[model samples]
Target: MAPKVLVVLTSQDKFPANGNPTGWYLPEFAHPYEVLKDKTELVIASPNGGEAPLDPGSAKAFENDPISAKFLKENKSLWTNTQKLADILPRVAEFDAIFYVGGHGPMYDLHSDANSLVLIQEFAEAKKPIAAVCHGPTVLIKAKSTSGEPILSGASVTGFSNTEEDQAGLSSVMPFMLEDELTRVTGGRYVKAAQPWGEKVVVSKVAGSGSTLITGQNPASATGVGKEILKALGL
Candidate 1:
């Protein structure tokens, strides 16, 4: 049987402070989905269970990318009818991995979501692969390992960088800068590409359980993150 991957997406559609629309980045989810869809069984899920929103800016920016364009046109139902994260927590064992897709949305919702934290912990305790990209790593900020240490402690990780955030002109709107938070939790091992928005994927082992934790620096690294997950899963 193909390995099953639980693809977690954000349901928050608007930024709280400005009410500017934000959701999962189109390329971040679409690019990775293209890489994993054929090799693994995937279940799309979100905090609230339905209608995971897409970041309109990402959609417009990457509209010309064939894979993302096709995914947007064909996979609407997957995002429109996501399984609730809480509902999937009980069946976490059924999945071989958990992937957190990113956008500004996660910084607001999944970062402090109780169910997301528990689910990540369960995956770590089970030594399952945990992957996240861009702002998705925000979810890991509050997650703890079985040993009670921050899940990212002593682990090399990468996510959307402060430079990229500022370049995107969302530095002020984001709840917290991903690079700073990830570095704090990882004890300064948070890595990134030499250049902003460049592709960078970091694969590390959870400190206690040795579960694979794969992360990407930005949307450009989404496919790399997916490939790393497949490698970790031995697929």
Candidate 2:
């Protein structure tokens, strides 16, 4: 049997207090999806089951990209019937790894959601390779080790930076600044690229666990994040 991966997305469609709409970032999921689909089986899920909104900007900008195009062309059950996080928990052990795709929506939904915490915990306990990019890494905020330490504590990680968030013009609107929260949680290293949108990928093997926890700084690092994750999994 092939390795299986569970991909989680945010259910949030509109920002709080009547802010602009958002969903999963296309490139972040596309690059990783295209990279791993041929080699591993993938299951797409959301905090809430069913349709997942796509970030209009990312969906529009990358509409013509081969991988993104393919995702749209093949609108199968995978696209329409996203399992709820709880529904998949029973079978979480079947997965060899897990992924989280980012968009502004994750800040509102995945960042502090309970279901996400459990899913992250299960994957970590199973010692699977877990990869998240951009704001997707936001979900790691709730993941804790067996000893109840933050999953990102002492682990080299990166996510959408405060500088990049400012570039996106969402510093004031986002619930809490992502990079700032990440840095606080890790209390170790939270590196980012010198340039806001530049690519940066960090892979850390948490001591005593042998599990690979990988993160990408932003959308530009999506493919790099995907590749590093596959490498960590020894593919």
Q: Top model by TM-score, which number?
A: 1
RMSD each, Å: 0.7, 1.6
lDDT of 2 by residue, 1-235 (tens): 7688889988998888566788888888888887887888889999898988788888788887887777767754564679998889888888888899988888888888887888787778778888899999899987787778788878888999988888777788888888888898888588999888999999986534668998999988999988886787678
Give a tens-digit lDDT track for model 1, residues 1-235: 9999999999899999899899999999999999999999999999999899999999999999999999999989989999999899889889999999998999999999999999999999999999999999999999998778988889999999999998999999887889999999899999999999899999998878899999999989999999998999898
lDDT of 1: 0.93
Best by lDDT: 1
C-alpha lDDT (0 to 100) for residue 32 of candidate 1: 92
Clashes of 1: 0
Per-prediction count of colliding residue pairs? Answer: 0, 0
What TM-score does candidate 2 reach? 0.94
